[model samples]
Target: MSERKKSLITTINNQRKYSQVAKAAVLSSAMLARKNSSSRGAPGSAAPFGARESIAAISDMLSTQHKKPVRSSYVESDRVEWALKIACTISMITVCLHTPRTIELFPPLTYIILAADFISVSVFMLDSVLRIHYEGIFRCDSSYLSNRWSQFSVFISIIHLLSFLLHCYQLIGKLHFSEISLILLFSDKFFPFLHLNYRVWYGVIRSIRPFIIIRLIPLIVKFKLPKNRIEQLLKRSSQQVKNVTLFFVFFMTLYAIFGIQLFGRMDYHCVQPKTDPNNVTIMDLAIPDTMCAPEGIGGYECPNPMVCMQLNLNAKGEGFYGMFNDFGASVFTVYLAASEEGWVYVLYDCMDSLPSYLAFLYFCTLIFFLAWLVKNVFIAVITETFAEIRVQFSEMWQKKEVTLDEGFRKKLEKTDDGWRLIRLDGEVEAEGPKQKLQWVSSL
Candidate 1:
């Protein structure tokens, strides 16, 4: 459509939205007033206009059903800005936690989380910078440059603190910052050299493990952050981050492979006494073996039907037959089953023993049913919950209403896109917890 046509359409819709909202609000207030009046046994309860008021109130409530939240201070301040900060922090931390670490004994799979963190941080940082650079912070009673701590919110103040510390930290370290680098943490000042927004650097600060996981309120706030038009931007960012992250994972995998080979050939075996843990230890060789199990369980006596340890390889490795087209289920199932880090694996742990998609659908049915029952039959679709949250928060923060809380579309898109994202949503659907009863009845 032409710009003029689009503008007209928008104007009409916005006008309609305002009217609907006003009518609904009026009705809700009228009923609430009537209920209070009746409960208090006020003389007005018997008034002739009482029925008329109630009827009008009902009409208003019905009219307001489809209306959106008003762009008031209550909704804007409490909703939009806060959600943005919280969501950005959460996204950053989630990404960072799954990413690989430079140090051993740290969670091995944290790199995936770290990759996600980088993208999340950059977007949030952009928002923070935008707020700092463009918002009417100057109009407030406090000075922007002077008394930096005055009249700031826990959320905004936290973002500011994180951005400053991280940016300074990055500049401090002479070494280059990788996605997982703790050094180039977050930014405080807007980068004059790179022209990057300082606010985005705040997201990096959010990834600080102590801030996210250790601080419960901050963690919850981070998860509840809002997004804007940058969802598509985030999608693209997620892909870029994942690709870069995968490259690192590949490198690490190769490194592990080499480490395995080096450790494997160390000639540290004691055939005489096999039961001792310290005798001829070899951790490196065990990695690949752990990753890729035996070919056929080698016809050895089975230890357990379900356990991977039961699988064994043939003792003898002769010339020709060793090169079978298939090495059995070991390299595939057992290795794959054992390979995923516990955190990664837990996602699928409660799923049905079926293919991922069906299992996912089953999971969704289960969670929805549970959450619905718990919420007293008020089934707030994920979209609606988020929409309400965004509206409420925007008012709380006293910020401009964000454009990204198109709740239904965003949630639906998340559900329909990529396998992993889909799996997550599918898991949220309604699967009744009464399956065991059904089985019992059938039996």
Candidate 2:
């Protein structure tokens, strides 16, 4: 082997030498690793045997099967999750960008990616169950259920588990040619709509768009952090949510004001003016005016239309809804795409607009979904960093470690350099006075 190849093996081997686990991995994969030659190709090329995976498969037994530590590194779990997730993300990007406009290549690759996702979901299932088993719901000291890790794990695990199962059902069904078209029709997002409760269904149908769900892994794993770290993270996330909420409220308040001031007043027409003989407009849908109808029956009888400014069409250049309009017709005839003509059509009532009442529901759902993404997905990442910060703060607070014989107060003295607390000998230096006493409430 060349010097570079030797160096890489040396580095990988050296890194693995710390833990017995790593040592086993290096030894087991040694022959497999040696086959590579830089002259032939890249050092870390794709595994000739199969797709590359550095993390060992979860299907392999975990020797230390004791309850996972509360503040665990989850080094293996995180590594595996990250490895597969990155692969899934890359493959998705590849299919979208370079893969040809063909049926066979797409489905096979899609199945592989989805299968990888299935494995990830399975890992989550195992993790959640293990966490629950380790951290029992009911504690002897406190009758109340535990808050640290397992509960949150169960909650997130259930959501993703259900998602995985539903996706799996669709995947299996799609393998059959007859179900392929239907699966293609409904797979990406409609499952959520179909599964949504009655209260949430309208919101799902009107504004739901397919989202790539790669960013949710770390989020579900967060509550497993140590108490101080969890508290600190929660504190930061809560603040962020508050700030975001305030910004959204202000933005939307302005948006609403702009809509009211800038939008023109309307002469009411029928809900479907061309289709319905009975005259009914949005105003009629809201108020049963004598002018709108002599009989008081506008809201009860008016038809509800789900309309969008249709852009980004499919292969046939069509929208998501199947029966919304006739396919192959003038695509722009019924649907608008924010063009001047489309805007004019909406104004003239040629292009239908969705009910304003439904928009609020969609808007609220979007806000919650975005908030969840930001808080759970984005904020969870800061836990480890937060933990590191906590460690620093803690060390700074505890100037010296107090031995059992020493005054338990951990003596504090205010001096020129600010309040300093003495720590135990050979421990860390205390940077500030001892904290005021606070009693813990019974759990």
Candidate 3:
């Protein structure tokens, strides 16, 4: 009887254990079902289990992820950023030295420049490829090529790449990459013409390369110089610079039109060849045969001091008005004149037939109004903006301090209303009473 009672107790214990396991399984299954239902309703949980991405998606991923492989580890690093800046500095210097004028001055410098260019181009090309990968090739709305600045950078990089290749071509001569004997033999004949074309392209590219200085300017401005006073000044005066630039454009356009009217129909002439025995060879004269006076004694020769003549009122070719037909040329010429660079030559060329007083008036107007008055205006505006910016920065710093004290974190958020600064705390609602209050008080 004692053994049978002990066995019954063991069986009861076993049954209780089994009941507990069954309860656990039921509870777990119920919980899983609830989780699955919730997940199905949740946003961004619609993807089917183990579904493969489409070929287009995979292609895009491959294209966009080329840089992603190293981006986090290298690209955003401060060390890399500084390295890039150094590379840009190198590039800028290389570009300056490689200019046709500079190269002409120092021909042997091309080899050194070519070496430097290789370094610069390699850096820029790698960077450009990575940037394009990051921005995505086919993203029309937000692609690498979409932003004007990005486009400028990529374009500059490509042109520089071509320039580098051209340099390599010149250095390598008729050396063939492939083992085709026909190409190798005939390359001697074909390469010179090809190189000549390349030189023309190289010149054009080099001329445009200076515009890369625009890209370099911003980088230079942002550089952390020892004093940082210049940076502070530039940051403070940014708004003023923008405003003044706009006004200057408008002013320049107006003056350019005025300049076109004054010097539109104009030309320069040479001594009447037939009349002057010193010029026995009529063919030798630069002036057209029609422009020279007859061989008679009383023939009207060009003026002694100057040989320039006024073109017919409706005349074209090389005159200010003829050039003005293109808007870009007109603006460039006017601004070029304003810079006083070949302004004297242009002044002499334009004013040969016009009154001397007109020259005085034109120079005075440009020097006094554009140079002095306009310059002072910009200076004043920049000074005002600088003061305002200083105050603005001070206020911003104070606000940041206050937020830190209040245990609040501010973040930039892009909403329907556009980018907005908002506190992370529950105290500030996204676009409700708290935001409205903050905006009103800040104003």
Question: Residues 1-443, candidate 2, lDDT per residue (tens digit)?
Answer: 69999999999766655454533343334323324332357666644522111111111112323234545535236675565465435434433432224425565665654565466557666755554455455755222145533355455445545554554554555455665545555654567655422232322221211122334445344432334444655676677657666754454444344333322222233333333323323442323221111124221223345211122223342223211232222232222211223333233231123333443443344345443443454455456556655653453234213211232324444679875544335366545444222222322
For each candidate in turn, the TM-score is 0.21, 0.32, 0.47
Name the best candidate (by TM-score): 3
How would you order the candidates by TM-score, starting with the best? Answer: 3, 2, 1
Q: Candidate 3's residue-wise lDDT over 1-443, tens digit each?
A: 99999999999988967755543343333334335565778697653421111221222223333232433534456765665677677777887787668878888788898888888788878887877777687777666787777888888888888778877755554345644434544664678555342244555665566666676676556532212333555776776688788878877887677766765433334544233433234343344422323223222355454242323322223344223334566576667766667666556544443555665676668766666777788889977876765644543344334422322244445789875545558474578898789999999
How well does candidate 2 score on lDDT at residue 7? 100
- What are the Cα lDDT values of the candidates? 0.39, 0.40, 0.58
Model 1 / residue 194 / CA error / Å: 32
Clashing residue pairs in all predictions, respectively, total: 61, 9, 0
If both were scored by TM-score, which would come out higher, candidate 2 or candidate 3? Answer: 3
Candidate 2: where is the Cα deviation over 4 Å?
Answer: 1-105, 139-145, 171-251, 265-443
All candidates: CA RMSD (Å): 25.5, 23.6, 19.3
Model 1 ranges with Cα > 4 A deviation: 1-154, 169-204, 208-276, 279-443
